[model samples]
Target: MVLLYDWSDKHKEGVTLMNSPVHASDLPDNQFDIGIVGAGMVGSALACGLARANYRVVVFDRQRPPPFDPQSQPGIRVSALSLASQKMLADYGAWQYIEAMRRCPYRRLAVWEKSAPRLPLPKLGGHRGTLFNCKDIHTPELGSIVENNLTHLALHKAMESLPGITSMCPANLEDLNFSPDTATLTLTQHPPVTMKLVIGADGALSQVRKWANIDFSSDQYEQQAMVITVEYAGKQQDITWQEFTPTGPLAFLPLPDVAGKHYASLVWYNTADNIDRLMKLGESQLIGQIWQHYPDCLPAVTGIVDRGRFPLIKRHAQTYFSKRAVLVGDAAHTINPLAGQGVNLGFQDVMALVAILSRDGKPLADPGEAVHLRRYESERRPLNGQMMLAMDLFYHAFSNNHTPLKLLRYLGLNLADKLPFAKQQVLQYATGIKSPPRWLFR
Candidate 1:
């Protein structure tokens, strides 16, 4: 029988339960209630949530996050966390750690199309772009920009503090087998563990999904993205902006000040070969290239700290669950990063799954029951699919040079800029303050 504790009222109090040693004679025949693969942001966050509800959770990851250093330069991998995501972290007690470490919050967001040859159309004075302000939506700030490593570390710390969670790091899943009532996971460095439910929080190339025999479809985008961490010659700014070109988008995201110096993360989207050429350039050469090609509004870049590149791909599993196994986060779906909703969608998955398993603060007797897993899939799959479609639309529309589509783009941005209701709705949706209605999913 699964062990359950009523943690609803005492969740704020830190709890501790030592994990059983690999060869401990007292170890239960079935040690864990839930087995989670991948302990990154999504997986760790899920572990924290379930543990808070007093579920015996075991998490497996191949590697551990490096210890954070206050003096180190920001990592090239960063994410813009929407308000909804922040709330989820705060609820799990991880946001406090993130705030104590480092984060940069932006109150405004701007997007515009770069100037190019235009067909005869009404020209708007100044830049034809939509600027979204937090005040417009009655929110204090839009979202916070955080280093991916810091977020992972914060969630990892929170997971460690929860008594109900057992973390197995440097442990690789050697094999997975599902019986009638439970799933067994064989790890390279640890004894096999059994659980009533197994979840795949692994990334796009999910081993759990593969082991479960779940099929997914993926499409590679024509453009690749290169991210550069740099210091700017000014104070920290409260805004993030993106300029769209026929090739791809040029985006600037503010990072927290380091040693009283302002820093920002820049993203340049282009063809794979072009990104490779940019990546090969020296620091000074790349800085010069930024000044030559980027929009005039970009601040003077003083020095480059680090840079990396990734190919864009959209993937979705054909189904979220197979038998006793289920998928979440990137294991379920991945969208174009044009809108920065990838992780927020993952957090949403965590919330929905947790809510289903721990209904009304009462842990289910069998968390892996097919009916409960189906409900979790039913709640998240459509929303993820919808967001994927929306990102695809933006990716295609902004990356095209068609004259007619260009005019439409200009008009859409202009209308979004001028219309109060439309702008507010768009802002709320983008910031994750609002979600699409159920009727739209019909």
Candidate 2:
């Protein structure tokens, strides 16, 4: 299903359909119900859901990721996708492609304190670590570690033949105009497009958000994440671990085995200064540093495959919608990566928004109406806020040298490990199946 559209003429305002043409005569030739300003995972997911529900949708992005290969070495950038998110992708028809391409499923997730050496667990007769295993809940696995590009590639593939989905790649968002009932997008590569709703899934610095005059609260996190891919010698393991340090949490997320060797992705969260110094070192030297600082539970790294780094920040749109427009994913909120919940949160937003818009089994009437969009905001805002705050609390509690905080966290972890119900609740939150206890918030 290689559907094609031509942008061969730079001056042309209309795209020429090449292969099997769409039934454009049924609807207005140029107008769309929704126009999404970014084709990243969130934007693409929303497009899939809406188009599958029979809503006209257009997704715009500067570029598309290359097709992923199951045999290729995994990238340093990866996400810990939750179980709830997996079902969403399955519904969107992307999960099958993703499964065929590559993914690493982990049955257990472990979190521990890096400074626990000072207070030996045996001496205190307490737990050595806190762990959540999928088997406890009768689930096959907690989730999967998927390469960022592979997920994007899967979404793009799923969207290729979906009815009412328009691909606007290699196109630039020139400007946006909003009337009382409509929004018009001006793109550099194509003509003007008028839509009832202009969805801003364009990420944190969303131009559509600014154009809609949506205010946002953004704070710079003190830590930067250093990500690296490693090739190791061993069987493919099925456990993900995060060890908290005064700087930040150092995590090891496994990758599927290729050939006879195994692989894993590492994320070292630390202050900007430390990350800068670490990045300046040679690969061998940096690997040596990682081996020294990271927990011994990590698999032996035979070679460093790749490395990258990015600064962390917390961002939340003051509101999710404005005149004839709405924001989703990183455009609405970006949380700390300590729990690897960023993408899952975005997928959750899409699911909520789709549920609100598609309840009628047809394209929404007056799609940009405040009444309709506000429902989405009301449903998602609190949950996203709770997760954001929860991550912040975890960050401060674990990423410090304070004795009292350390001891408190240790005792809490030991207790949590000993209590079956408490551990299940935490897993539910982490896996996006349920929210934290209501008592915590009250």
Candidate 3:
């Protein structure tokens, strides 16, 4: 037995939703055109986009992001948002809030392999490594390094400002059921709500994917990543760099200045046991280790703010849709964070799905129609697969001490450095400026 509410057609204007739980019985109607689970960066952005397209949207999450505080230390988690993703955020009206808060813009990206002691060659210089300048591609900057929570907060603001969005936070989905035309969501704190389409933007551990009976395959990598937030003894940097060693890559992403102090995030990839050992070290000891192993490009570390670690895993769903439900973002696929393209790929998923749904200048009469769902899956699956494969290749090729592969990598880096046209093309692809077949947009 299920309960249904008489949904209203009139849109509510100037409604600002809070993070508190809302009982289904208290609403004008419990039904919505779309119900989204997981109000993270991707989920919140999807809710805002769908609402802007005139679809009534309800978003559910177990918790809400804490309010942003400028006085607080920088978070260890951040994402390098590419140009294409930036445009999408701007289109959804969230970029304004992000800019108003804080963001670090980087104009150059550098990649190089550190020489092994066993090798016959001397260490490489900055000139020997491949550097990508935004000037070469005629862009002011390659991307912006933003805190994940800040992006989520901005999108939440954007969603609250919209007329057709209902945000249900501090709420969890107890159960989900599907019918021929709609899906029913059972909440732990609120009554059951039904919608034409249910989006599983929850994340890698998506319960929606499980309830929909969708199966996915995943593979864990040999190396795990440890991220550290630190203050550097210098001004804010405009360039980000990564140095590949036999263990893994050590990377740096700049963060905005806090109270005139320069801040940055560092990623150290190594075996799980090694990362655990490193995590056990005192802040001073860890900073000493970083200075000993990291490249010469790293500035002096003033202090350590925070640190954390996560295993690298590759996951992809067998299919992106089942019955009345569809998947997006980490719910559908998760690739390597080597190039920092994970969030950008999720934003691309949002763009493709929203475009497919509103192709006829308006959303389809049935947002959950099988044809529309299949089209969305078709557009995203192969592209995501390609990116995953590329990352795996990069991981394997650079994580070994093989002599021939080392020579090849050395040659490849120098070759990429010398070829202006090739560098530009790679830059465009990396920055998410490259588009799918134009027909997909039409």
Candidate 4:
């Protein structure tokens, strides 16, 4: 289904493929019990969750779905979904569609020292250290790599089958008013509506958040990230590799074959100035630079399909909930993408908010009491806080080229590799199983 969005005017031009007109009369006075801003993965998932709980729901977004053309422009960004996260999407009835769309599962993951040669396995009588694989966890695959667009599409499709869901695309809030007991939004394109709760699932630059007067603290990272899609001519094994480098951590995330060609998503991290210089480089020149950095074990350069760069910033709102309004996903926090935990963090937020608002066979209406919102905030803030701190420490330690830090990194990786128990523990943490502060679910 093609859902072309025409944003010619700030108001009155938004419509979906079904050609259903959205206007003030479409909404009943005090009709929908909940309103969600933002239609990204988190927002869409939350909308489905609430609808399943039997709450009247509406979703507001600026972008509309493009046709599902194979030759369509590929999305510039992607996300890594953990094992538990994949299950959550399945429960929401999107796994089948997402699996058929753009998911690439990795059966094994391999991490090695970047600058140095592959270390020889330690000898056990006549044999060396054993190689570890995903089978250690009793599963054949570690996780799946999904394009941002595909995930959204699958969720959006599932949402269509659900009752009590009304999607408003290419719409923005022209006016908003909130109080301790009730919240109201006046969409410029449609009639005004009031609800018991308003959720900010919009994104980092959330309009809902701005209208609610929620302040956020942000930190700017000196580094920038470049995303590239490359063709590797080597074996098409199901494995993902991460190599810590002087500039930053380099990751190769696998993709399913396209007519027998092997493809991977690359994340190249470096200083902002250096990234700017490369952004201006021609396609051939950019490929040459990548070859210079990753010479060995890299497949022949089939092509660099798409490349883009962006400055890295970490943001967290001062509070997750205020009055009758609440924030979730990038609306609440933004973290480093190095560990591929950004989406995972958002999934946890959805879980916590849904648990508080919909569980125990309670009313699907207004879960907006101060005490209830406080419970949501308390569960997510510390968890996200700890993740931000961990990412900062790893970024500083591995990206720095200081003499002392070099020795410390080498010692750390070597020790972790030697100790079987430590290695397994680290694996569990990376796989989102066990951690200092575990996720709200599992």
Candidate 5:
């Protein structure tokens, strides 16, 4: 249970625990209107939230969502959701479904200099100043690990009964014509439709942003991330780990599964050349490399189910909001996936935008107007910028193997640990529960 503060109620404004509503009808088109592109998690969740505010919503996607089949595939398509995001999903009625199928409740996360040598080998593996425990903050769980598909499915399920929300999947976006008055989306099959606003949740390669003449700036990282699911020989843990190497960062995120049978989602980030070599290696050879370098946390690799690679890229639209169109999620910005904040940031965008438009003071019919989308941009930009800067700093800091620099990086981690409040602040910021940008506080 959580308490929601009402900025208005003076008599009993101190604290009031709130229960999330179940299913709600879709908002009527002429009443509260909006259209979201991309039926992914971010788009679907926003649709549900907007519908709950009594806003008519429409969503478009090119592909149909696969059924949530746990046995068929049991790995996160590589993503970690923050606690704040989890709460938002729960409020949107997505948590129950996702938690049931693919949530790994992680209570503790440890990060340290694995390359550092100690007097004794055990001491080297000892808990250094870089550990985060949820119990310390009186929280039941630090964060929940979720699969991208599961989250989307859960959101789709929530939007089922929403009256004003229409989801058109397997539909192609042929054209986007936006003006000061209305945003019209021309579909290949369906009749040309118009809405007050058109969202660009399409992805890194956003068609809506392109059609709307929204320029974007981006750079591809020299390194590529290799993500795979492996069966580990250990207990199911609530720990997320990252080891900074000369090439890049490697991570092991725990997955929820049967007791004693452990599973992990592994991300091996390295230069493109090395990644090419690793990809050529058979599954056994790749697992061997993981075991060799990852000594302490090395889990015996029993199986290799799914494997994929994604070239890291950073992109941000030249403008976030214009006349009758706006961008969100990857279409707006995409940063290094090292910290796993990409999707979390997108979720924040949805929550903040929804909160502002759903407020009583906003215009009802054309909430997607310049004034409204501008408000959304003002609220999201600074926060997104801060996160992007942080990623750049971390990326550059760990990308080098200079002896002095490594020591300095270790010192910084140690200092972060010694300062309790500092550590908590970092945790709070990274996890997206608090320390939201000033505009979002409204």
Candidate 6:
């Protein structure tokens, strides 16, 4: 069942909804209020969120998403869910479905430089790295770790009963036409559908972004991420941590135990050459590497379940909107995965866009009006830019063996550990619960 809040009407609102396809002939002149291209987590969430607000939403995806299975081995593609994202999912009724499946909640986060933990320098703060505990901040958990496919499937299921949404899977976008009042989308399966707005929630290589003529800047790093899933037997942990080595950061993300077996998702970021060599290693050899390099808190890799590799890249559209369309998620920006903030940033974008479009609960003169789209762009661009820059700084400082930079970063991290209030603010920003200081964006 689906419930809605009527913004135009000042009173509390509740309404049950059903999902059905709105054919091209069902609407006046075959026009939908909104046409979203991409049914991944970001796109599906936007469709549901907008549909709940009474907007006629249409979503298209090239392939149908596979069903999420709890009985299967963990997938290599997973995401770190922040507190703000968790609240959004719960509000949108997606969290229950995700929680009903397999998920892991982590309460603590620790980050440290690999070589500086033992250096005793009082003038430069303590030797150990900074640790942020949820208990210290009065929260039950910092975030949850979930499989990427599961998140997409959960959001897709949530859209089932949303009244104003229509979706076509195994449908690919062929072309797009933009005008002042409406955008026309030509798809492979259905007749061309016209709509007031088009959303590009597609992945890094966004066709919607390309067709919209929205210029973008992309940065490809020399580093690559090697991901692996492993089964283990040990005491369960509620904390996730990353240790910065000369190559890159090697991190452990906790996963829920199944049938008395503990599991975790491992992320090893390093140069493409090194990642290639590591990827070629057999299960036992890779386990040996992990056991030798990782911190003592993690469990031994008893068995390997899955492995994958991806290159690191940073990209941001020069403009988020063009004519009657706007971009969302990786279409608008892609950041380094050093902190796993990519998807969380995308979810935050949906939140901000929904807030602007649903202002006063009254329908806008035109949902895709330049003014409204610009408003969404104005607020999100600077914030994403700030995070991108910060991550870049971390990458350069830690990836290199430069003596001065390594020392500076270690000292700064150690100092942050000592400063409670400041560290809290940083944690809040990192977890998407709050914005960073405005000056940082500037």
C-alpha lDDT values of all predictions: 0.87, 0.84, 0.87, 0.76, 0.75, 0.83
Number of the candidate with higher lDDT, 3 or 6 = 3
Please give the distance, in angstroms, between residue 263's alpha carbon in candidate 1 and its true position after superposition: 0.9
Report the Cα lDDT for residue 89, model 6: 86
Candidate 5 local lDDT, 1-442, one digit each (tens)? 1011111132245433222212224222321267788878778888888888877677777654567566654654847888999999989888888878767888887777666632332322335538888865668878877778788888888887666676655556688886667888887645676888888888888888888788988988888998888887756677898877777888888876744466789899988888888778787988888777664675677877678788999988888977678888888999999888999889999988888788663436768767878888987887787778778888888888777777777777777766788778778876776775574433
Model 2 lDDT tens row, 1-442: 2222323342153554322223334323568898889889999999999998788887777666765655688887889999999989999999998998889999999887766645544343454668899987779999999988989989988998687887766567789999998999986645688999999999989999999999999888888899989887666789999888787889999997776679999899998899889888887898799889988877778888898898889999999999889999999999988888899999999988888888666777777888989999988888888889989898888877887787789887777788898888878877877866666654
Instruction: Say which prediction, candidate 3 or candidate 5, comes out ahead on lDDT.
Output: 3
- Candidate 5 deviant stretches above 4 angstroms: 1-32, 117-129, 258-260, 361-363, 436-442
RMSD to native for every prediction? 5.7, 4.0, 5.6, 4.4, 10.1, 6.8
Task: State, as a TM-score between 0 and 1, how close model 5 is to the true structure.
Answer: 0.87
Instruction: Candidate 3: list runs displaced more than 4 Å.
Output: 1-26, 116-126, 436-442
Q: Residues 1-51, candidate 4, lDDT per residue (tens digit)?
A: 112233324333453333234354544444467888898999988988888
| Clashes by residue pair, model 4 | none
Tell me the number of clashing residue pairs for each predicted model: 0, 0, 0, 0, 4, 1
Worst 10 residues of 1 by lDDT: 1-10
Model 3: how far residue 143 lies from native, Å: 0.5
Question: What lDDT tens digits, residue by residue, belong to model 1 across residues 345-398?
Answer: 999999999999996776788998999999999999999998899888999999
**What's the TM-score of every candidate structure?**
0.93, 0.92, 0.92, 0.88, 0.87, 0.92
Which residue runs of candidate 4 sit more than 4 Å off their true CA positions?
Answer: 1-30, 71-74, 116-132, 361-365, 434-442
Worst 10 residues of 6 by lDDT: 2-11
